[model samples]
Target: MNSDIRQLEPKQLWNKFADLNAVPRPSKKEERVIAFMKDFGESLNLETMVDEVGNVIIKKPATPGMEDRKTVVMQSHLDMVHQKNADTDFDFDTQGIEMYVDGDWVKAKGTTLGADNGLGVATIMAILESNDIEHPAIEALFTIDEETGMTGAQGLKGGLLEGEILLNLDTEEDDEIGVGCAGGIDVTATRTYNEEDATEIKIGYTIAVKGLQGGHSGMQIHEGLGNANKIMNRLLFDGFENFGLRISEIDGGSLRNAIPRESFATIAVDAVHKEAFELEIKLLADSIKKEYKTMEPDMEVIVTSVDAPAKVMDLGVQEGLTRAIYAACNGVYRMSADIPDLVETSNNIARVIVKDGNIKIGCLTRSSVESSKMDLANMLRATFELTGCEVEFSGSYPGWTPNMDSAILKVMRALYVDLNNEEPHVAACHAGLECGILGTNYPEMDMISFGPNIKGAHSPDERAQISSAQKYWKFVLEILKQIPTK
Candidate 1:
């Protein structure tokens, strides 16, 4: 735990957050964090249980005179998106996150801060451990695999939780309440390729696209930020058509939820056209720079000499893969007709890799409307299938429709108005939240999601504002105190 963080306001919350940072809790791999939560619950003499899918449920009895209020389920995921800068050397499976106080915010060095849901998890831990704070019956629900897949929320059974009101703490903005969220599906396309000896190539070079500000695919997709995979493919397709380039390997992106920041490809160019190819690449880079000058001023395109590979992808496969990727849909597809500024449907071309004998492409499609989500997924499937690649879709989750008359929403809004002297912004998010799945399991539960200010989630530049953390903690405590009697 960092000493500086322990000195922050809401001391208990910051202390618990520091403790969480001392343990590795990457998405889909949260055994240590789960154990930590269990031990913490036991230490408080509270009832604790782990569900079949690893979701942790800790129950705490209400304080004297508060038992009459409805049970409030404070929810957050245990796992976080693990992302690091290309130059950083850290292991997500074993190493604890190294974080430091950066002026008014807390940030990790060359790596993600994990504050997206960690702060929420730590807040619940602090509440469970504190005896001075007043609150009604509490259920701290810590879900797993929220970043890569919402397995914990998906597998959670109905009737297991008795809470009538759910307070989801995974939202990023401090001033907004997330009343609903978009559902999502994962799509993958794969095609086996034949390799042939590299005979026509005289010079080999590695082309790289880097230094772009990759963020959460859903939250930041509408920002018009550069997609590394798309940018690299543009160069590859142009080179293949005009420079007679032969690709040996292609790799880009790391996670499906994150916009790709870097892409690399190894290719060969005939010695006769080397100068022309270099000139063409330079021109292409210049053009791309101009296109994204304001959004991605730091974006870089570099080419350097490399050893020639013994094998290269077949000409047909190379052209087909390049063309399909270039033609694939990415970013926002539709905007909400009801809610201003809300995304109704979107797609993220998240990852691409070429290895062994095949090339694979991965995409995530999201929408508030189920039919629209499927329509976009089918569109992506058709685009890849037309290129002779096999496509599969999985991990589909339902969207949460907003309830304007939600009881908890009214309580939280009144509480926030009293605390901040102003009404909070209420809206639905484009990003996938566990609230959608949890709502399905407990249809009667009144749900609302809000949290401290967290920026750059799913990226190395992630940070959490300290002042907002303090304010959020106070706001939540006030909300707990005002929960209506059941």
Candidate 2:
């Protein structure tokens, strides 16, 4: 464990965070973190339960005078999405996260900070250790595989928690309370064709889109971060109509939930037009950069050469793949008409790859309304089918539907007004949260999510505002203390 981070506020919480940061607890590889949590709970003399998939449930009795208050489940996920900058040398499964304090924020060096849900975990730990705060029975639920799939929540059996009220610690913003979130479905499309020889007598160049500020697809999708794959596809389709360019290899995007920051395509073109091709690529990049100046100022596009000449995709396959990706949904399609400034329906063209004898494309669709989500997914499936590609959809998790008149929402709003002299902003998030799935598992439960201000989650630019942590901590403590006993 790094000794320096132990100096941060809430010493024990930061100490454990730094220790877990050194354990390489990326999604699906959380055994060490799980063990650490289990050991911590055992040391606290709390009843602990861990499922086969690494989801840990630690039950703690209330503070001395609040034993009769209603039990509240403080929940957060255990796993985190591992993302690093293109230049970072760290390995997700082996190396520890290198974190540092930047002014009033905490961030990782050239990688994601893992604060999306880590703050929630650490706060629960701090609450568990605190004898001063008063609250009812607390079931600290730590779920697994939240970044990729809601596998832990989906596979959850009933009767895990005794609490009917759940507080989700996954929201990114500090001042806003997340009452609802979009449900999401993963749609994959694939096409296979026989390889063909490079018949076009053409020069080869790699067209690349880079430097865009890619962020969490759900959280920052509205921020207008450029999608490299989509931009590259647009450039190729629009520019190459007058030239003969066939893509030999195409690659872009990393995580299913992050806006792609960079993408590259190797193309075969006529030797005579090499100079013109480079000029066009430059122009295209400049055009996109100008278009998204406010959101992605660093966006860049480039052309280069590689040695692999024999392996090339068929022109038919290339055209079909390009059309499928370009035609599919790329950004927020519809804003919520019901809620002002809320994104009601959106789609992320997640990833594209040529693997295992097939060219596959993954798209994630999200919406707060269940039927709206289905409509978007169906639209993408229809679009892919038009390209003669086979498509499949995963079983989607439900959205956490909002109840503006919720009892807990009322209490939280009142508490914020009492503490901050102003009402907290109540809104729904575009990102997927486990509250939806968990709510389904326990239908009668009331759920809401809130967290410290974490910017650029699931991306290399991730940072947490240190000032927000103290406010959130104080607010949480006050809420627990104000709970009424039966």
- How much lDDT does each candidate structure score? 0.92, 0.82
Clashes of 1: 0
Give the per-residue lDDT of model 1 (tens digit) for 1-486. Answer: 378888988899999999998899988778999998899899889999999999999999999989999999999999989889999999989888888898999999899998989999999999999989999999999999999889999999998899999999988999999899999999999999999888854689999999988999988889999999999999999999998888888899889999999999998888889889999999999999899999999999999988877778898888889988998899999999999999999998989998667899999999999999999999999999988999999999999999989988998888889889998999999999999999887988999999999989999989999999989999989999999999
Once superposed on the true structure, which residue ranges of model 1 sit more than 4 Å away at CA? none
Give candidates' CA RMSD values in order. 1.0, 1.7
Where does candidate 1 have its weakest 10-residue lDDT segment?
195-204
Per-model TM-score, in order, reads 0.98, 0.96
The top-ranked prediction according to lDDT is: 1
Best by TM-score: 1
